[model samples]
Target: MSEVRSEEEKAAEARRGPRRGPGPGGHAMGSGEKASDFRGTIKRLVGLLRPERALVTIAIVLGTISVVLGAVGPKVLGWATDWIFAGIIGKQLPAGVSKDQLVASLRAQGDNQKADLLSGIGHLVPGQGINFTEVGRICLLVLALYAVASLLSWLMSYLLTGSINRVIYGLRRDVEHKLGRLPLSYFDRQPRGELLSRVTNDIDNVAQSLQQTLSQLLTAALTVVAMLIMMVTVSPLLSLIAVLTIPVSIAITAVIGKRSQALFKEQWKSTGELNAIVEETFTGHELVKVFGRRAETEAEFARKNDQLVEAGFGAQFISGLIMPMMGLVGNLNYVLVCVVGGLRVTGGSMSLGDVQAFIQYSRQFTQPISQVASMANLLQSGAASAERVFEVLDAGEQVPDPATPGRLGGRTEGRVAFEDVSFSYSPDKPLIEGLDLVVEPGHTVAIVGPTGAGKTTLVNLLMRFYEIDAGRITLDGVDIRDLTRHELRDQVGMVLQDTWLFNGTIRDNIAYGRPGASEEDIRQAATSAYVDRFVHSLPDGYDTVVDGDGGSLSAGEKQLLTIARAFLSEPSLLILDEATSSVDTRTELLIQKAMTDLRTDRTSFVIAHRLSTIRDADTIVVMEDGRIVEQGSHDQLVDAGGAYARLYRAQFAGAAVDIEAQDGMASVS
Candidate 1:
């Protein structure tokens, strides 16, 4: 009798579904440890730019020159302001000690010829108001200097753009190459979405930060240093006041940046988590719909999205305070310098022009300090991204291909042996320990067992997808590990239950097994697998495009295509992993007929859940708890009434009941 679900139970299921939280794909990303070696990460990131040293150096030189020119422009403008004041005031130069000081200040501004020329002219034009001719030349010189600085700034930007592009291009390429070398085990522990985010999103963030910060780094440093010296040269009193803000601003930035840096890392991780949820949710859309889980799925998405929003807000808000705080400190210092400089000018300790230049230098000094403070966030984010990329590059690779790889020459006899082989997915728990198995050439070995009986592990070891912890698996008496993976796997064909077909025509997917196969060869293989039954009915026949993993085809039709692929490969050893378990009766019969035809001279290992399918197998190896408990022909196993007999009888009774139900439904209809 069926038990009825309560209203509350039904509502609970409607609200929560089977999975109310993140699925298997949304595992927390990263090692969750802070980056201890920030300097090392920076050094390694800079090392990637080593190839473009010459271009980067040119950019640095140009940037430094532009910053120096910009810094000096304000001082020159101050001199101009003083000259304008003097010209308007009908210069009967403020005499005595002030006269000596004014001349000395002019000479100290540099360009002795220009200063001496202006000083001699000023005496000649005393009480005559101003030297218009000399003023125009000074103004034009200042304008030309600024023009050259502007030109160099543009050129620097151009050079840095080229250099950054080349460096980032190589970085992306290295990341891609690293993915190929990473071991399958590395992928097992990490979510696919997180790895993808590192490759696409993290590296992109690094590139953008470098583009903005790398070009300005030299300019900011040079500006700060030059401005500091100029400030001290103008008047050490004001210089001291302006310099006081540097340490204070740095302290504030450090505190705020430290808080935001952690938030940025979390933001990136939350982004990956969100992406994982989307990937897993959409990939299993069919399953979600079948179980009426749309509401629960949306709830899960909302939870992940909210996490992303919170992380983003924290990171941006904390980092956002840096520029404003630094600006406030700088503005306060500016007002202090103004008051002190004005008082010194009135007391005649500093000339009007010198006081003006000191004010300009004070402003210049604080600009770079603010820029550096703000750059703290950029540098930290870039460093975090670099560390992520480097982690992938540093991950352990598959045991390097054999130094001296062995080969499987000509046609192999398919003699596979697992001699006392011990293996485990992890060291803490062992799956198969000291197991022994041997299959002679041209034999059909059916592996029958309950789920989790290490049925797939045996094939995984045989194919060397995983290395055995102890003992050795041999193909034709040669250790499979001795041969290159390509050389060993080339002769083995697999047809798993999940058919993998790209978005291409049927011919292309079938020909994937043999890239060099001819049209005739494909047709012959398709005919052998009975794939032509459906292909010929299509409008475009073999050319019909398969989209969304062959969504248009039935499960049985996809299986036939995979079988055709295997047939075309003409492999000596075939591993059929539950290949026909999910098909209907007619499709199963067709697949069985195709398998009988294809297994004539080839060695095959068939993994099956239904006992009746393996009745004709040459030998049945029944497994229980990762150990083989019974081995014999079907009749022998039934006669013995062991694990295999019990499994066979249960499947038989189930099949009979299913047939009875189908007949009753047909009668009622």
Candidate 2:
């Protein structure tokens, strides 16, 4: 069980650092755009509570009892007041006229007028007009009702807590499940912080509102209806006076609520904007310092921060106006009820007790109106959050898996082919068209070209990360589309330029690709990838913990761990995408040796950043503008004097110049 913390303790913990979770905190809205379908969002939000109908129904029944008991308490008190008045007046009572008999007589006469006046407290007294003991009993009954209602209120809250928690849990689980089904392309355009926010912040907002506002909303509604009924039961004349101000209260609320709704939308949007800015800046703090952009970044942050403040102020200030204005309307209605009741009392048609109860009932009626007025902001905020969460839930998912997927059992020979494949990130601008490439088994194909040469696009198609616009890709003489993604990807291994690592021990990270791999298997793979060299130096060896994205390790070490992970997976087809681009010269040499050994018996496609690294590849395909310009061995490409030769010569010339500059410096020293 989680120990509940005090507000101060929670605040202290918050001050320490960011909260740990599956996703980053702070920014939550995937887009700053306000939800256009307010009603739809609310409908979906309510639908989440369908599973808790039994609990909700019980809460409603109990809530109704509680509101009714509290509403009628004032009227019961009025009965006691009439008893005290009758006693002081020294009025003679009819013989044997018990409280029940008088109430029956009053109702038989069709005069609920004095029935409300004398129902519960009218009992014959020996010398007194009204019985004091009976008066005491009625008062005690009202008090008991109040006490029972309070207990019911507590029970209702307990029930709602469980129901609301389940609903929130379901919502979060849906989001987690949705994320797994979404395609990688969806994440490419989205900010990581914003997606994290949707899961963490937006859902939290919805949960908080449901927890805090749900019971109040139900109670306020019940109070309004029940109190109105009680008020009319007492005296319809004064009830009319109380009811008249309701329209005025509503008009005022509508005006203020409209402004608040609009402002609240902008407020949340501004909050999302601010969160995005903070996330981007903090995540790129090192880059900002390297570029000497601190002042400019601060200025940008201040501008967004200022917008958030202004929006927050507008939203809160407008919403805050609701309570004061509604209070004024309620007070005016109170005065009207009192004035009318006082006139009726003086006219002998109403008793002092009746007047008092009417006044209390009037306050009760308008109090809910005021509460609802105040709840406007919370409702609007919750609706906005629900919209954001629903946006993710409703987002387009990846292409569906085949109904009956083909199997890739045993080892694959890794003969890959692209047959007239065409693709484009955008429909209008085709990047690769009718592109056909075939790699025989155990051949290393090096894709070389200038930037935006459709090299990575080819890899994306091969992996089916994104579906091609036309044609097919095959592995081992089988169309990849016919196979399940799990089956196809199981045969392939990928190492990108940017390495990714989680918060775990080195052994755990390497074993991720092969969860069932034994300790011996992991160690052998690590040794093959040269990760064992550094593992021995650490006190914990493979048990050493890596921080965020393996920040504890150097970029080269992180890459090496990823390579070891791939090696452990034992993929038949390998892809090395600029795997050593960011490493030091010594680290690069080690990585090259490890990669060469790993690729010896597998068909590999190397997307090289440095031309020299792929000099020993079996084939080099030079591409530009989505079309292959030249294809041959390294020596064949150099001798051909085509696009491949030009690119090779340029890289070679740059390397020669760097060597000469280094030699000059060394000679001078």
Candidate 3:
């Protein structure tokens, strides 16, 4: 019994954590954890895009065409510049003088440099002014190229948006499905707020990051490549200068990105922890106030908020360095290109028009690099969120149902039998061992025990909420595991100590037990469970609205509603775990009467700490240390003077003293 209590205490402590807080010593949960595999997480994120691969491929093609056309525009515009310059110089020279004759005269006049400079302008018509027709044609051609590029770029963005949204939609759906498949134990270990962060906040961040970065990064990459090729075609020297900045830019990105990746991971982890704290605080706000721990709770929230702030600041600040550093490198490359191209043009080896185009190519090349660098922080943040989401998706699921499930045959008799069952929450601490019990159809078995005597665990095992480590539990001669979970659970109805009601009308909440149940049947169950008494006082009667917390309803009233819900189910087997714990004396009496009527011809298992409630049970089983120590009618156990007798004596003795005090006070008055 000591071991059982100790194990139960440990489990409770795990759920509550230290000081009833989010983590050890009230720290954030998993705050120190880091992503184990950054590259692997990125690969998995890319895999999510695989379903829209065809759309993505088309988008990529369009982006490439857009970038290529944009890149070619500068080189084509260079032709117009050359033509304008040629006409300007030609208008200054003597008309009727051929370009060769002028160059020869200049060389003969001992001006070889001038002659060579004039020799390179092949399109120059000596003595003619600028040609408006040719320049206008070139301008129109450049305009057309830019217009087409813009249209293609817009189409590419549209395609990417569609693909990204579809992928995110599927991701959210998978997360929802994954949650359904997870074992109860997983939820026991995880904080509700932290899990919500992963499902909502983290997934939203992933979607936003993908949406903001995917198309931009693709366009930036192709722009860099196309621009480089155009630069090389115009002037190899300038292209080399631009290319040299690549290594430096990569170095900057690598160094800053490595540090920011860790920070981003910390930022998201802290975000989840902070969310957990807020959720826990809000969910238990009344309890926190009742205990007067508002200051302490606020202090904890502040501490977590501080951690998140520090992490977010560090992540953004470090990533922000990439843009300016790349810009500096780009400017230096630009200066080098300008100086070298100027010297080459003066020496008649390169034309001014080509130099002008090369400069534009150089600028275009660096712009994409800068753009990619600027998005590093978003990419890292998204990757961190994706890793967190993948953790949930990759979590081990509960044991699956049988492929070919066994049937209970027609009309289940609710003959539940535990055959040499053994189970434990932990391997080293056995809670129940070789436990055998059988309840026939139409029998009401009441279970009584101390707080940690495996009473509820037994019911949980029977429901297959937690599978037994050994042996089989059967219903109607068929092993429960052989039946599908849904099939097995459908035959059972349970009313727990804690009541749950969703935000809906009273009638809707009751009808939740048996969907599509007729309105008349719902009211009949509510009347039988005694919920109709108070519900009739309300203006809306069964149409009155209530939330999951049973807003404005008294505890006893909420408990009655849950009871009414169970009555509507009409299960073959019923399990009531402290069903009357929350009610007053009058309500309790009414519920006992209703339960007696409801138990007719149906097997019922009642777990209770209240000895008075189960005195008339068909069989009272007293449990100690996970084993049945006494089994008989209440009078039979009392006569035997066993564990049950002592419990009965202690309880009634306390009650008798309270009554005597009241009588004495009445006499004195």
Candidate 4:
């Protein structure tokens, strides 16, 4: 009943996907733990950028230069206006006055009305083709600068935008590479779909924010600073009036930006949850339909979707208000500047040009602040993404390989011994308890056990997939765990009950264990596992594409392919965990023969439920619960009347059948 309950609970949890919420217990970052600290993540990502970095760098440089030109152009225009107002309008110069300077200054004015006004204010009659022609030249220069800057800015936009997509590919590749190398236990705590969302959706968000908003923010800030400085130099009072709206704008922006940032974070978190739900439901679609729980699934998904909508709206709503508010506040400041600065100009304290320049400066000042308010949502999204990135980068490393560890070569004879082995998945519950075992070189040892009897767990130990809590497993008298897992696994081969095949050709799958194996070697291994016939029967023979988990083949056929793969690996130690369970009775006979051929020169662990398969095992260990209740040869155990004896009797039923079973033990029927 407890087993049934556990299964039911697992099924239910699997349906819900990774359980998550915006609870207080999340990896919330301090301001100091900025995303910039993700050096490992950055290094890995940069490694993938090797294909496009040169072009990408050129694009970024061009874009940055264009931004500077555009920003500096406005300041130059401000300076031209300031010169006309300050020097020309005041009539008598501050010092070092000359008519050439006076006429040249008018030419540099650029704007006709402004030049004429400054000329009129100057009380000088420096007219004719010479002065007006020079002014035309100055106007032409301003126009040329504007055109060039704007054109490059537009071109840079296209180049950088394309580069952003290229960059995303690099980032995705690096993220995948890192995930592949991470230990399996990492997945035990974090859900697969959630991690996928980080790699895909969250990373995309970060890319978008950096490409779109961050670059613009940098240029906008410089433009604002340039404009403010020009305004202040021209007329401090006028500049003061224009900048009065700044503090108000900043206050409004801060409140909105902060809220938007927080909401966008929630949005990303919710998006991950939404994706997790979709992944969970899709994988369990058959069960969901069979259980008649479609409505419940829809309802659950709806709840998550609504939360996403709320988060998105909250973020966008605050961000959307930025442009309109900035424009409104800026226009209001424009009105104030015109009124006050106009009064000052009429009273001979300033000029019409000064008023015009001050208005331009006001716009320049507010534009960045306004844009940043608009960018608040993007910043928040990026911050959220960076938070996740930092989380992965800052995550603890797995148990590392020891320095100068033993290396296992192909010559390993595969004598394996577990000396007083004990293990636990968690500290509170031990899985294997003092699991002492010895499989002699070139011998087949069968481990028979019920469910939760640590059958597969023992396989995990043999492969060094998990670290043991106590004692040691040795390969050729050297501790397996002391050796790097990669080295240890090099000499061991495992064929799991569930056969997994990649989306590749049959030949590719067969050769994956040994990439350099010749076609003849591949063919021989295929023949040994009895997979050669099946391959020949396929439409494309070895070249047939096995799409999606080898779904084209039967479960038993996939198992045979795995067996063939194991045969190709040709490891010194072999583990057959119910390897033939998926094969038919006829196929099983061939596989049994293949197993005999492979097990001749290597130590093998045979874990099976079929009693007939283990009859010839040099040592048959009958396990109940977690302990080995009894062990011996088939005849010896039957004569001893232990757990193995009772189990044997139950299988063969009578004395005659038992004796017959014992007779065929040397070569399994």
Candidate 5:
């Protein structure tokens, strides 16, 4: 176990995620972004669009059709108005009998054919009079067209919501998969709050904005183009007047977009920071209460809350200005068009029908621009959220898995070796250096150290949670770097000092690492770990939910569940960190017996304070200040009179009653 490798090579094989932009200690951690960041965000959004191609196609087609329906209604109404004026007031009815004769003729036709006759006249027969009766009929027809348009628009909203959510669901699934495959060190730099923000809040923002905001923007843009062409066709002078309003409105939108985008980015960051504070404080609630730091916690939370408020206000302040500004400009453009078109009407340069159609077209022009302006806040919010999501996607992945992962089909031998292994969580801070060790198959080795003494770090390296700075680790004489992470971890079992049981049943937690375990296997494993008896005593037995850190169970019971988990895996190599430390005298003795049964025929690395547990270990490596200070068997170390001897004697001098209890670490559990 002494093959040395350089820092670069170690980092390449390490399970820790790649470090990007420099962070504290010159290690890269994502912090925040600059204003120019949104450009990259837009590019990323374009990529996300490819997956939703079908939805996009449907939205585009339906949106255009929906807008056409809207424009057609007003134009139809204007045409019917012309027919009414000629038939009722102008006496210009198309050389037919008086208005009364036309009404009587229409009345003689059944209501069914009133529609048919109206349709016939709508075909523009030259000699036919469009009497008041026909004009009134057409007005009802215009309303019917608009009713259908409104229904289609509502349908489009639902389709847009579905399209966006489907994309979001796909993204969330990918992220969950990535999290399980990502290295442990990836979690080290990332506070749980920040990662949660990415998985939950940021992703939700992407979906929500796509549903209500982005789709509307797309609709508005398409509508504006369609309506502008309609306006120019109706009358170029009026179209020109309406088009002038677009540039200034867009410029205002741009300015507000920048300010709100920045504010929104800050808001997301602040949200992560605030979440981190909550998680940290709540997790360490015991320590905080003991120290009476409630006021301090409150002050910190208030500060974060205040910052969040300021950011929200700033973003809202800018984006909120767009709609009123759009309205004022649109209103001004409408008045101007009316004045110019009215002059043309009086001069007989344009027909009254043309002037009326121009007015309708002008409103259509402003409608899209105004609608787009209204969605500005949500657009900026989406951009801010997009940048956050991309940050994770762009952090670079853990070392790529092999094309065909090499699997050891059978139970792997437990032989282990470490070769000149050195490591550092960050470049400037080294945790272990040139560590070398060899444990033959089925040997139990105990590692001892003070706080931060790197004993846990040793187990971390063996598990490939973080890559060693130099050298390599191996199992059965094969370098672990060449092994698939999943394959390597499958043969190894770890029971952390702090056992984590997900929101699941006790039986489920026990069988988590070995899902195919039968109920008998679970019970036998728990029995050997001394947990079966306790479980049998509970009202629900193994079926009970272990929620809130298994608060329902005692510390000893929780540790036993973890031990059962490790046993169920039947791991070739086991790392138990202070396994029996958190138990009463009786519980510790029971655990000791359970541990003895599990240790035979398995290579185990243990970190425990009770020297008695290691008395039978094949080897004992004692650490002080991050270095191994002693190495030998338990008896040999007791005789050496070094750090191990001092610690041993100190514990040995305690009453045998207290030594047997060995329950000091229970509260920590």
Candidate 6:
């Protein structure tokens, strides 16, 4: 019963949307994680960008150009400053005196320091005012360079956005396809919510990370290089001082990032586990309430939520330290450059304008390094998500369909035969071994057994839901493995204990059994399955819309709708697995009659626990421990007093004895 309920919940969860809630620390869930194989995952992520290499290359070139232009702006402005200062000094000198005469006069007065300062001001006339015209030209040139750089940067961003979108689009498509190819066993082993996180949350994170960091990384790197070149041109000594901070920043980032990477990985893993719990709780809320486990559920949620918070806080705190540490190093480097540059300028080895320009270059040099260091967390988070997504993409898929798929000609005879079929969920724990059964065309076979007796497993084998470990199952003498799965399933229709209905009108739900089925055909199937009796009483009748959870409908009504769907399909083989188990007595009788009509010429496999329901079946196969212990007509089995007879007596005779005892006690009272 638990397994049955689990299967039902899985079906319902698959149809529903993911349940979302604020994660720990009031942030959205799945903020980020770290990859175990950081370098390998990063390499694979870069491989995804290969298709967009051309656009990426073009964007990089534009970004480089923009950075170069922006980097040179400070140097150009510095030249204008030198010009104005030279003019101011030259204007203070005698109107006709040359710079050489001015210096000679200073030295003759025994002012060697002043004479040296005067000599350092190159191209300064002794009797000239500030060159406002040249200064204006330089300002305009700086403006033009900035404007062009901004334009190119915008273009580069546009190209990168397009390229990134295309790459992510392909990635999502691939993941979707990979999901379709994966075996059912993979899904069985994984939680739906965890798998969903990989598909939705993790993939979205990867896209966002790439979008946020790719262009900025490129720009920051190029800016760093460009600023370094400008700084070197202005003053190599100060440039070298700025360069020293790089090693320190790298060391800090490396240490903190390594620790934070593990935490981020834990944070996302906890997010997935929490999501699975929430999904399970939400889907089974009614069951939880019935069992009065709401408090336990809440406690479990709190524990996992707390785990997520701890992991998130540790990861965030460690990664957050990088920016500030990098900033401190940058500030120290800036102070050193200032002191050195000032000394050089005062000693007449460097001009005031050159010192100012080098200071600006030094700031620019440190800024990109800081930006890159801060982005380490984002990169690690994205790499972790990419690895999770890659795991799904790398999972082994189901056995491929036959290269030359065998087809069942227009219609199938529905003669299913299992020949020495052996299978198991685990290598050592065999569930079905050497199981052999043959269902003749147009015959109804009832399979009855205790729970875990392989009743459903037998049907699953016939449907090829799972492959057999040895031997083969055949349909009309053709091996099932030789035919495509689609072809094999086309002839089968199933109505499980749990009914699955999408959010659609009754008419549409019925038509889903046979897509493109006409309205008259849908109504005919509904009438045959007893759905018409209640549906017509409703305001919308066949047009009444039902939700995915079978809105406002009784359990029996939901069961009937599923039977009507199977009836509409008119499949060659029908599987009724406890189809009437959930219905009341009257409803069950009605369903039984409908099923009897539906099964008229179709081969049917009925798995039931109710001895009364399968009493009239052509053959009753009693199974235990994955093997059929008894197979014969119902009456024959009863007369033989075997497993079937014992089961029948337990259901009917036991009830009779209990009723008689109650009557005797009432009479005595």
The number of the candidate with the highest lDDT is 3
What are the RMSD figures for all models against the true structure? 7.6, 8.7, 4.1, 7.7, 8.2, 5.8
TM-score of each: 0.86, 0.87, 0.93, 0.79, 0.86, 0.90
Better of 3 and 4 by lDDT: 3
lDDT of each: 0.77, 0.78, 0.85, 0.69, 0.75, 0.83
Q: lDDT tens string, model 1, 1-669?
A: 001112222232333223223343334455436654567888988888889889888887888788778777777766676666567643654433443465577678865553443453223333445667766777887798789888998898899889888988998998888877665546655666677778888899899889888777767788888888888888888888988998898799879988888877777777766776777677777878888888887887798789889988988888889999999998899889889877676554665677777777777778877887788778777877777778888888877679998878877999888899987765765667888888889888999877667787788677766678999988899899898878888888888866778888999989988999999999999999889988999889999999756868987889889889999999999888888866786567667778988887888999877644577789899887568899999889989998988988877656746645654665576
Residue runs of model 4 more than 4 Å from their true location after superposition: 1-120, 123-131, 147-174, 289-295, 622-627, 634-669
lDDT of 4 by residue, 1-669 (tens): 000111222322334344342211121112222423233443454454467667656656666666555555655554455545444435444345554466467567754444444443432333311234444555666777778877766775666567667777666776676765565445545655567678778887878776877457656766677677777887888778777888988888777776676677777777877776777677667677888878887887888889889989998988788778888998888888788877675554665655666777777778778888777767667767766765665565556778888766557877788899887665665556887888889989888766566666677667755577889989888888678877777777777665768899988888887779999999999999988888888999888889656757987889888888889988888888788878776677678878888888988888877765687889988776456778888788889987776666665556446545555774564
Deviation in Å, model 1, residue 551 alpha carbon: 3.4
lDDT of 6: 0.83
Ranking by lDDT: 3, 6, 2, 1, 5, 4
Winner on lDDT (3 vs 5) = 3
Candidate 5 or 3, higher TM-score: 3
Model 3 lDDT tens row, 1-669: 000112333453343344223432233465237554668888889899998999999999999999999999998898898889889889999999899999999999999888878887758889998888988999999999999999999999999999999999999999999998887656656777788899999999999999999999999999998998898888887788889999999999999999999999999999998888888887778888888888998888899999999999999999999999999998999999999998887778888789889999999999999999999999999999999998899888988999999998656899989999998766777778998898899889999877677787788788777789998999998999999888888888888876778999999999988999998999999999999999989879999999888888999999999899889999898888888989976577678879998888888999886754587688888888678888888889999999988988977657646545654665576
Better of 3 and 6 by lDDT: 3
- Model 1 alpha-carbon drift over 4 Å, by segment: 1-40, 91-125, 652-669
Q: For candidate 6, give the lDDT of residue 277.
A: 74
Per residue, candidate 6 scores C-alpha lDDT tens digits across 261-372 of 8887887778887887787777677887888888887887898899989988998899999999999998999899999987787666888788888988888889989998
Q: What clash count goes with each model?
A: 0, 2, 0, 0, 5, 0
In angstroms, the error of model 2 at 215 is: 1.2
- Which of the numbered candidates is closest to the native, going by highest TM-score? 3
